[model samples]
Target: MNRIPLRAQALGARLAYALPRPLRRAIAGRPIRIDGQELALDAQLLITLQRLSGAGMVNETPEASRRKLEASERLVSGPPIEPVTVRGLVLGGVPARLYEPAGVGDDAPLLVFYHGGGWVVGSLDSHDNPCRFIAVNAHVKVLSVDYRLAPEHPFPAAVDDAVSAFRHAVAQAADLGVNPDLIAVGGDSAGGNLAAVVSHQQVLAGGPVPAFQLLFYPGTDGTTRRRSRDLFADGFFLTSDQMDWFMDHYMPEQDRRSDPRFSVLLAEDLSGMPPAYVATAGFDPLRDEGEAFADRLAASGVPVVKSRQADLIHGYINFLGVGTRFREALSEATGALRTGLALSGRKGADLNT
Candidate 1:
């Protein structure tokens, strides 16, 4: 539990993974190979594991859980981009924050972001770093919604908030200094699920469609168990217990799982949705479902860019200092965003990545 032991363990993990192929095999036995590359746990993840060793699947009250997270969590991100003006405001009758990169003004692209905390613990602060990175890297304004949490405001509440917030962002584009048509929607984990559902809801209503959808390790189907659940039930960061708690609080009724709003693939039609950029971690329990959703989107004639970080686990975005793959993945996803928003060929100032 001491810092010395933690650092030592992290060093050991790093050295162990760096050993020559035969030596590593001789010492730690064979490593799992994914996409023909060794899938050994990285040192940054070793430190994270040490920090999370004592944590359980949050059974305390939501407030207590949130406090626990805020007190202990440490997310070391990439070098901060200078002059990123981050400000908080109320949009669509809900809490939200805006991340504005330099040189962007009215008619610039924007993204309405949602944070991932299993519909429970995340807040504007928890996702601030990623929003900053997205805005600066993709050269777009990011509006992050602090939507209502669950048990107090359960299923359909977050969905409603996302739709309202996205609509508000587009409608008030001039005031917010962004192009109404280039407004995109995105999020991680549960937030990603909400973003996908939000897109579907808008299409079903036949109005106010977003320009793009950026989903990272989203939960697409909750009604039925998939092979991924069995294979990745335990370990790999996001455990089964945590997921069970999130689902129970968000949707207590099993029947509701069948709804297209929850089980997105069950939707009769996925047509008319915006372009999508999907990212998934191979070690994650939700990996299969996320990829499945991407396939569905492409099949529905939606332009899709899929990136699979096979060696990394879930929530790598928050593990900024711990991995280089996170940066690589973020850059790729943002590149897709730039293309979708037509930012690559813009005549004026371009975002330096």
Candidate 2:
């Protein structure tokens, strides 16, 4: 994996994020071609599909899904900067990985991330590159949590672990080398959902809430049949059947879906939550729910920035850290995190996704 070239990519990322939504949609709607692939398929997503095809799933067991996601993340990640300062430790009883860029200060802001995979598959390794990229580009510390998977530890188990991890990080701010005031909580897909739940729980408990929320295509209202769910249910990487499988294994009981912690969109009294930055893919089945959550947050008086990466599909952030257009999207996302958390530094590293 080659590190993304900084000079041109840094400028391109800025312009790509600055382009208006309609213009982005116009450019994305223009179909392009990848060698040995079908039309209209994003090149990065094609790479991901090729990698996933090699890790065939025998069953939906946690072990099988973890193997599958690890392949996808590994194949998608580009070469990172040499000798990155990555370390590992157990937060309380749950394991975690910390990605710190060289020369980070003790006052650097921190991002506590939960990996995606519907809360049943992803591990710290599955999201290692993204965390590294964010830490380097945004000049912040990124702590990726490895919470217990479902079916074995269902419902509130992941939630409990996430909340515990954040509290522990806060309590050990000096030892962890981060600014407690600038700490943020974020995740993608199921991980995003968990982060939102933690933010809400922290607010209600009258404890220190996260400074910001970074949600990527979060599964907010699982019970609602949003239009994107039906439109992109069949293709664009995540299918409705696949979601049903994840939800079934994670929750099983339909009644559990209504719990505010599980379906954050259903939560009452959304006031006093942390400010948020939400990024939703154009073709993801969870697009509507993620957007709805952003709207809900804004309506509740929280500062919010809602961005739609209209050219990409779900999980494009896993791109091998290169100068591909997909990596530019991830760069834009890190920019948002940097601004939201006020991670002060020279911001344009243009690292791989």
Candidate 3:
């Protein structure tokens, strides 16, 4: 592995440390108060992300998704690489993207990726770079799904859309230039949750269960509050207050929170699921739950690899071009994906299916 230089790492850390105290405080805490009422961290982060997103910021929905997507976009853009588009008719709709890569011939294993945004934000455009990098680095085709978001569509709506998309991809594998049997599901945060749930749903529905699952700091259990939520909740990019806000906007009704389809951690059984590569960030409030979910999967006798990004915050995967550590983390992740996909004996299938 090519490690980042110490000086560069130090510079990145210093830059992170050098932000204005108030801005850092806001980045690390709740929103700034213009009045007596507390604005909360998610709102504050959204505003910060808006500034970072540059132009084309959408006014609808909370600021978190837009800002996160914008920051992610800026972090991953670089010189052009090989790009391919695979169209699939799913959920009575046509969805696709540019799958950039080198030596990604036909029959490469497919990675069906769902983008994260509290299940209310994120789209193919928001996560284009990461998907492209995964396609190129992992030597596989990545089918990035633009699942339906919440507020407008809630609960099973996202899951249903994801399942439909995955199934459609699998059914039309040949048309999309990949093997149907080598499909895997993956996502970050909320997208991670959807990937897990969708895999389980596929298993129950029978036929076409993903060969593997790649979950990055997934939002697992929605019921129990973990210790990390309080300990690392403040300074990290994702805070406990922000999580609550996301949950509020995402679930709204309390009844939906306990549904295993909505919260996979609440599921009664995790047996017979695909092997998993679970990544968590040390400073993230979602850390504990992600780790706990990995533990549960391990307990169920599934092959699992859990990695913690000690010096990073939430949503670091999307920052692959900004920091050396980000690329390192992405490389580690892609390596894991390659190993997992290879072990399934489906290597060389076009991944864009």
Candidates' lDDT values, in order? 0.76, 0.77, 0.72
For 62-157, candidate 2 gives per-residue lDDT tens digits of: 687777666545544655644458889988888899888987898778999998888788778777888888888878899999999888998889
Better of 2 and 3 by lDDT: 2
All candidates: CA RMSD (Å)? 5.0, 8.7, 8.9
CA deviation > 4 Å runs, candidate 1: 1-37, 40-44, 51-59, 75-81, 343-353
Q: Point out the worst 10-residue segment of candidate 1 by lDDT.
A: 344-353
Candidate 3, residues 1-353: lDDT per residue as tens digits? 01544344334434543566576555646544421334333323433442443322233456655764554354344333455454443434736553636676677789989998788767776777778778878888888887777777767778888888888888878776776777899999999998999888887777678989989999998988898788666645666776777788778888668898877887888888898999987667888899998999999999999998765667777654432566677789889998898988644344434
User: Against the true structure, whose lDDT is highest?
Assistant: 2
lDDT per residue, candidate 1, 156-264, as tens digits? 8988888889888877888898877778899999889989999999999887888889898998898777777777677666777788888888888988887888788
Error of 1 at 257 (Å): 1.0
On a 0 to 1 TM-score scale, where does candidate 2 land against the true structure?
0.83
Decreasing lDDT order of the candidates: 2, 1, 3
TM-scores, one per candidate: 0.85, 0.83, 0.78
**Residue 22 local lDDT, model 3:** 76
